[model samples]
Target: MPQKRRYKSRRTNYRRKSNKNNRTTIILIAIVAVFVVSFFGYRRYVQYQSESKVEMVQQDHSQFIKKVSPYAVELGRQYGVLPSITIAQAILESDWGTSSLASQYNNYFGIKGEDPSNTKVLQTKEYTNGQWITINGRFRVYSDFRESMKDHTKLLVDGTTWNSQQYRQVIQSKNYIDAAVALQTDGYATDPGYTNKIIRVIQKYNLKKYDEGIK
Candidate 1:
């Protein structure tokens, strides 16, 4: 009877140890799960912050476009051209008013003239002999930025001999893309991708709505 009681006590002790081990395993699993969830949550938060910053930068660019739109619209009203087209051209040609020529000479439209008496000579890059070569070229210089804008409008309205009529008709359509393409087809820019870039800038900032005040 003494031996049997001892054996029964030992069995109870083994069962208790097994239950304690199982509880410890469960606790470890719960801790690991919590740590994994926290890591993923932190990663998601970082991603959200990065995306928000990008969106804020884009908003700033849009605001800058808005600030410049009114002047472009007024210029168009005075010159009988499309406001968005004028703005896009200036932005493209002047590098958003950061170019040296734009700052110093107000020559945003890159107008060129052959008359040595009136033309200003500047060193610029030109494509020649299968490579880019720097050469002195004569470009039209304006006394004011407004004068450059005026000359750009005049070039579109009267100087273009091929598609002047088509551009004039499309400029009244209130569609920026149409007017941009008209300029491209009429050789307003030397770049083949000029029209697409203008369209992208206009659409990205929703610039066409400003034209409502022009009429």
Candidate 2:
């Protein structure tokens, strides 16, 4: 009888240990599952935030284009310049009107000024002698973006002081490609890739549509 009772006690203890081990395994599995789910949830949230920011930036760019397109087209009609080129130049020079020079001084074209009162001295980057250089320059200030656009159109039409016909090729070119090339050949910007860059911008944004039916 004593031996049977001892055997029965041992059997009961073994079953208790087995039950405890099974419960511990289940808890561990639950913890691991929760961790995996939380990690993926966090990643999804981050991805969503990134996408939202990209969408906002795209919207801002579209709005900037809409605001400037009409004025650019009107000026192009009046001055015989390509509206597409003008808008592309503004997009590149002003960074969609977000640059400090554009936002503060309303200078979309980075035109220099001789008069101190009508200019703001700022640091600028220039490509010189096969390298980029930083230099301080007095940039022209304008009352508004309209004035800046008008001034830029006039500059292209009238040309610079040293050469009265500097941008003649640009104004006379029949297409945006030739115009872009002319801007580079005519020394509008010091960047070696200015022509290609302008062409790429025009193509990417379908700026040539603005030039439709305009001679």
Candidate 3:
């Protein structure tokens, strides 16, 4: 009877040990599953953020087009400047009116002015001596978007210098392509690819349609 009792006690201890081992194995598997799920969850979160940013970029583009297209058409009809080039330049220069200069002062054309009352002092990158240099430039400030557009058209039409004929080619050009090329040819912009950039913006936004159906 003592031997039987001893054997029963050993059996009970072995069962307890087996139960502990099984519990440990289950806990390890649970931890691994949690880790795998967390890793995939993080990846999905990152992908969602990237896609959201892309969507926001597209939204920004459409919003810009909606805001500026009508004004561009009106300005072109009044000032004889190519509407496509005008809108494209506004996009390129002001980054769809998102730049600090445009935001603070409504200065879309980068027009310089000495008026102390309506101006924004901005750090500009100028190409000088075959290199780019940062300089503080005073940009003209306007009361509204229409004023800004008016000022830009005035500059291209009347020109900045006393000689109001600095960019005559642009004013005389019949199409957006000619005006874009003329802007570069007449040293309106320092960048070598300025014309291409303007043309690219016009094409990307389908701004030529604004020029259409206008007398």
Candidate 4:
């Protein structure tokens, strides 16, 4: 009878150990599964945030283009300037109408002026001596973006005070490419890559289509 009782106790002890091991295995598997799920969830969240940012940026750019295209097309047709060139210049110089000059004073073309009452002194970067330098510049202020666009078109048509025929090539160009190169040759901007930058903006946004209403 004593031997039987001892055998029974040993079997019970073995079963308890087996059950403890199984419980431990289940706990470890559950932990691993939780970790994998959390990692993938976090990855998906990050991806969603990145896509949202891209979509917002694209929407902002589209809005800017829509707001400016009508004025550009109208002014281009009246003044014989390519709307693509005008719109591209506005986008590049004003950073999609977000720059201080564009947002506050409505100066989209960065036109400098000397009038004390009609000009705002602002810091501007110039590509000079093969390097970019920040300098104080007096820029003309306008009542609205439409006025700014009108002034810019007039500048191209009437030219600067020193030379009345400075931007003649820009108005006479047959296509966006020629107009972009003419702007550089006509000294509209000092940056060495100004022509290429203008061309890239026009191409990226398909700004040439705005010129369809004109000749």
Give per-model TM-scores. 0.60, 0.92, 0.84, 0.88
lDDT values for all models:
0.75, 0.92, 0.86, 0.93
* Per-residue lDDT over 1-215 for candidate 4, one digit per residue giving the tens place of the 0 to 100 score: 99999999999999999999999999999999999999999999999999999999999999989998988888877888888988899899899999999999999999999999999999999999999999999999999999999999999999999999999999898899999999999999999999999999999988888988586
Best lDDT goes to which candidate? Answer: 4
CA shift of 176, model 3, Å: 2.6
Best by TM-score: 2
Off by over 4 Å in 3: 1-21
Can you write out model 3's per-residue Cα lDDT over 66-97, one digit (the tens) per residue?
A: 88778888888888887888889888889888
Ranking by lDDT: 4, 2, 3, 1
User: Model 2, poorest ten-residue lDDT window?
Assistant: 206-215
Off by over 4 Å in 4: 1-24
lDDT of model 3, residue 169: 92
Considering only N, C-alpha and C atoms within 3 Å, which residue pairs clash in candidate 3? Answer: none
Local distance difference test, candidate 3 = 0.86
Go through the candidates in order and give the C-alpha RMSD of each one to the true structure: 6.8, 1.8, 2.7, 2.4
**Backbone N/Cα/C clashes per model:** 0, 0, 0, 0
Backbone clashes in candidate 1 total 0
- Model 2, position 8, has a per-residue lDDT of 97
Which ten contiguous residues of candidate 1 have the minimum total lDDT?
161-170
